[model samples]
Target: MRSFYGVVACLLLLQALLGANARAETDTAAAPPAEVLTLHEAQRRAIEGYPSLKAVGERVLQAGARVRQARSAWLPQVEASWTGSHTDLSDVDVESARRGARSALAASGATAGLPSTSVTGSIIRLRNLAGGAAALGGIPESVDSYRVSLGASYLLFNGFGRKHTTAVAKYGDRETRAARDEATRLLLQAVAQSYHAVQLFRERIRIAEADIAFNARLLKEAKLRNEAGAASLSEVLNFEVRSRAAEAALNNARNDYANARTALSVLMNMEDGTLPENVEVETLGVETEEQMSLPDGEAALQTAMASRPDLMRSQWAVKRAGATVGQRRAALYPSVAAFASRDASQGGNSRFGEDDFSTTVGLNVSYDIFTGGRNRAQIAEAKHAQKEAEYQEDEAALGVVSDVRQAVEDLSTAQKQLVLQRDNARYVEKNRDLVAQEYAAGQTSLALLNQSQRDLVEAEGNLALARVSLLAAWHTLRTATGETVKDWPLD
Candidate 1:
């Protein structure tokens, strides 16, 4: 009966183990795949969804509208109008005729005439005129008049103001476009920096994890040695302290990783202001010396001057300002316009008959003889603005040169540091392995083993940092030379 119970217990344990294994497999199968975020992908997302870039794009549209508005001046303007009015002549016509007859008789002096025939003839003529006037006055009590007209006017000349205004608008449009591109360039640079930072911090976390694992293994071995009296209590204590410190470092690294991810999310315009845990940045690859080679400084400077968006924007600004000066100068000359109109009119009705139609055409010339010196003042202001824009262009050019030179220098430094760090890390790692084995064999002290481990960790961290720095420097150089903008066309 006891043997049967033992066999039943063994069967129950086997069933439980099989069930646990099945559950483990199910959980593993249910885990989601990590989402990979490459540096290029980050930049692409930022360009697509970033708010400031969209705002600048709106400015480009506004500039385009202004260009159309300025061009509209070159077209003819046409309009149609209708007017109707009724005037009451209830007593005015009769009273006006009576007053006119009295004035004519008083001024003629027919009674003082030298001959009877002359006096008779003059009185007869005045009576006939009075009768005609009285008959015309009784014809209507009110009169209605209606007029319909279509008119067109074309500007013949405006002292080239239209030309210059259109030029200014076009240049402004170009300037706005360049500004948009410049905004995009800056945004891409920001995204690349944040993306690299996330990668850097992630690498640090891995390093910390490795440190923890190494210390844990050593501590376990030391504890085992202590139990056998092959290692001192202090040796075990030392490894325990190291393991706790590694944990602290891991925590710090994790916090840094979170912060870096948050920064990258903001740049990407993510709603939550952080990347998900399932999202992982692509690891940076090892770089070769040839891949890290520097470009010719002079060639880089030339490229920057030609390709930089800010520099292009400044150039456009100068052109726009010059056009504005011409636009202001236009007011010094006379303006000429040609106007034509066709009209129809009817009296006593709203009807506009063909017989009532009339056509008129004429030219108008206007000159501002004096404008309180306003025109000159405006021209002077425009000239000053032009000069300001030129100065700004010069400043922008200088800035581009400075950025290119600095970026080149930084790239050179990063390349050298990466090479040194790679070699140092390899040597340190070998030294750590040797010291660890020596300490196990009781040929080295615990302090030496501890020092070697710390050195190896430091060396690995420096190597990772160097790799990120070199990559960052390369991107910085591309940005400085405007290659980044060229590579990622907004269109």
Candidate 2:
């Protein structure tokens, strides 16, 4: 029997263990996979997952809840409650009081009249009955009580304060929503900037790599010419130095690229500032002419005024402040409300059913007759706030216009500069090619070849920077106008 019991226990334990392992495997399988995201995906995730934006989203929800709370004033409120208590009602000596009253009445009466015995006897009997009833009524030491009640009050009128409060909350909610949108836009812009920065560094590194290759080729030619007794030792040494410098520059560019990538990953809130290997950015491709066209400054400014979330938020804030002023002014007027209640109770140290129920319904009106000038001060404060909000809205609009204009100007300048830099790069490339051919033919000095190569590298780097600058300017213009990249090929 012991062996059989042990076998049963071991089987049960094994089954439990198997179930636990199965659950663990299931949970592991259910876990979400790691993300591989594009630029758009990064922006989406940032807006949805970033702590700052989530906080702002919480504010928006709170504001919306406040609006509902303010609007709830018009709805009826109902509640129900039950109460039980023990009360002492033995303070009064009812039996003694009744006997004293009977004695006094008999003394004052004219008992000397005929039939005094009978009348006195009847009065004595009546007094005895009353005392007995009083004694019985006072027999209980304490009274057990129970009460159940339900009540509701509706704000029929509150000098329109309820309406004004609701309006204020609604406007505040709108302001928060606009603020959140603005925050999202800014976050997207930050991601774009960081992502573009990474691309910029990557391009620069490529340019550095190209320069390294060119220098390596030159160094090899110089070494070969010197071995053949055609090149001077000084030329060979200069080529060696140039090659080393190019390698160093390449290393620096690579480091900068890594840093830029890390920054982008951080902005996107990726795990450990690391992006998935499969993710490919769209804007890292070669630039095209269509992607570089500058929008009209006037049009951009117009768009900014209409679409900028901050400006819209400011506008709503002004309205919210105006509603607050209304709410404050409402304090000067009276408010009327309707109320209703029902109560049921039982007492006398008895059962629960031995009780009576009562109902009450009424309308209440209230007005702050004297507030020591508090209401006036609040009204004044609200008005000042309204004025300040209005001023801020106007100021924000002006700032938007200025930003749009400046961004347009900067973008135009960058575009023109990019053209000039590209032309210079082409010329430098041609000169470097000529110098390379002459050096190989033993006709040109190594110093001239080195100078040409250096010039070409500088020009190429400048051209790459100019392209990045133009792109950044375009992004700035779009951001200032509350727009995004549209009709522009990112890659």
TM-score of each: 0.83, 0.80
| Local accuracy by lDDT, each model | 0.91, 0.80
The deviation in Å at residue 342 for candidate 1 is: 2.8
Regions more than 4 Å wrong, model 2: 1-38, 87-142, 277-280, 283-289, 348-355, 485-491
Tell me how many clashing residue pairs each candidate has: 0, 0
Give one digit per residue, the lDDT tens place, for model 2 in 28-121. Answer: 7986664445667767767656788878888988998998998888799999988888866554755555566666545544332325457678
Best by lDDT: 1
**Candidate 1 steric clashes:** 0
Cα lDDT, model 2, residue 92: 74
Ten residues in sequence with the least summed lDDT for candidate 2: 482-491
lDDT of 2 at 166: 93
Residue 74 error for model 2, in Å?
1.2
